[model samples]
Target: MPENTPLLSVRDLSKTYQAASGPVEAIGSITFDVRPGELVCIVGPSGCGKTTLLKCLAGLLAPTSGSVTLDGAEVREPPKKMALVFQEYGRSLYPWLTVRDNVALPLKARGVPKAERQALVERAVEEVGLGHAMTTYPWQLSGGMQQRVAIARAVAYQPEILVMDEPFAAVDAQTRADLEDLVRRVWKDLGVTVLFVTHDIDESVYLGERVLVLSSSPTFVQEDLTVDLPAERDQLTTRALPRFTELRTHVYEQIQRAKRGEAVAATP
Candidate 1:
């Protein structure tokens, strides 16, 4: 693929589930792409098919009507080049395994040698500031710490793209803020393409280079807003800026309209 080509592309993607009431459309035809090193956030109301979209993008579920391609290849199943961090970190991590082992599992599955895997795991743990807890089990750590372990595991794999599905939703406000910044820092340092889904408007604007807003159930892209905030964004300064407030208001109004089944204008 060309350097400028998107790392991942979704072409007219749609998903439907067979229900007793007949076919229920979860996501309507929608299209988007994630460029290498770009951070894209998707936001929508509850039951707006955000999770369905993530599942399709991660190749965990096949789309009923469109395609997701990575590096010019169709994603038929879970792609080794992509890693997902879900909201439920407790369930995502193994309680029986030490933090180090949990972080190393993906590497081991990929046939990475023990020596390299150990080095990668250690580096990742330290990056997430969990170096001192390598021997700790998931059940022993606080919710924030366990989530950090999950992130470390994803980073250690060094996937071409990282897909986060409301990864911080289960955490407290303070921890969620901290994790948001951590994700931004990691994205900047590692330069991996990111696709983050969230219901939090502030979070979507805070962490994303561009925010993609989706309509209500049977969802489609409602608006795509490019966040023009400075690269060195902090919660206090960035959130208080006029531009930040403007963007947040814009997205908030768009989502409201989406819930009403009205077309929303793209961000100017």
Candidate 2:
């Protein structure tokens, strides 16, 4: 319960799959902790099992060894206090449902009362700047707007931790920048802990308080680097800072090293 204690703890977590040939280890071992209200971004090479690691943390997949704990309890199944937003925004949203209904679905499943659910839905829609699109269906919106709907759904759930796996990858450059700022605004406003996984180095630097770099294939923690930039960041001004360039360049080098198999030992 202490502020310093980790809200989510991952200890020597690993995952291996049984195949026809042999056991293929996706995650060698990864260890990290996310404190309350911290926004942490994870980056690694394409095949470094970042998604696999996130699955274990989300309790959607069991690890081969070690553990993922939320608030001191081992995560066995998807935690009720946690929410996930995936990369494929179009697939996640129900084409049949209106934006309001899609955002309210989770609350409804959780048995939230109709009045409270409506209030939460409206507030979340407005928060994401989608107040006018409440009655529109997912199929009717642009790609970026649909992603906003996905984010609104997560925000409306009032999760303690929001796990986003490449949530902005599908949008265009301008939209991606807008969504990045939106995330920061929402994070600051709600004080929700965030664990974001992205392959983009710049995105990691822009969004995270700490960026955890993962090693190649049999993945491990290559580096856990902190972002020392000011809290209030704009895409143009923040990215142009000399410190930003240095941090991003450093992360880029670490990832390149990871690809070349220069893995540092992860903390046990």
Candidate 3:
């Protein structure tokens, strides 16, 4: 695939649900594109349809207007080449299955041979730093380790694009920081196009190559801001950088502005 070509394209997409009261609009014609090998984060105020937009992109929900395409093909249903990591690690993993089994399930589902699935599960477990706990059950491991298993499962899928909807939201602050670094390393080493949705301004600046800010209720794309930070980001050095502070501040103010219904600058 061409580097300049978009791996995922979301064109004028919006979602409305038929509710008892009437039609409740979640997103209002939002548009954006994520190029191959890019890590983009979508940030917005609470209840701003971030999840709705993500669901549309994931092909788990049909949009009321516009479209979502992956690799030039329209996304009508969940694409096999894509993998999703949700926030709830506890419910994501099976309590009865060992970590290795949990990580191997996706490959098995895809009809991969037992030998190939074992190899993939081993690699993914090592990649997520969970090799030591592979034999343990989900209930036996810590929250962070369980999430690592979840991540390992996604990695083992060998997806072209990985979409995460607040995957680390439930972890502790320190664990969250560690997982953030882990994601960057995984993205770099695997070269997977990542679309990470988060509510944290600092995290958005820390992780994204570009941060797409969404407007409040009846959401739309308010801004498409490039992060412009070094590709090799660290929790300490990157967060301490002057540019990092500036970008986070800019995204922060944009969320505040969106809450207040003020006009937001498109891109900067």
lDDT: worst 10-residue window of model 1: 259-268
The runs of at least 3 residues in candidate 3 whose Cα sits more than 4 Å from the true structure, single-residue gaps closed, are 264-268
Give the top-scoring candidate (TM-score). 2
* Residue-level lDDT tens digits of model 2 in 1-268: 7899999999989999999999999999888999999999999989899889989999999999999999888999999989999999999999999999999999999999999999999999999999999999999999999999999999999999999999988889999999999999999999999999999999999999999999998988989999999999999999999999999999999999999897778545
TM-score of each: 0.97, 0.98, 0.97
- What's the lDDT for all of these models? 0.92, 0.94, 0.90
Where does the lowest 10-residue lDDT sum fall in candidate 3?
Answer: 259-268
Candidate 1 regions with alpha-carbon error over 4 angstroms: 1-3, 264-268
Q: What is the lDDT of candidate 1?
A: 0.92
Clashing pairs in 3: none
lDDT of 3 by residue, 1-268 (tens): 8788999999889899999999999887788889999999999998998888888888899999999989989999999989999888899898989999998888888999999899999999999998898888999988888888888999999999999989988889999999999999999999998999999889988999999999997888899999899888988999999998889999999999999989553542
Clashing pairs in 1: none
Give candidates' CA RMSD values in order.
1.8, 0.9, 1.6
Model 2: colliding residue pairs:
none
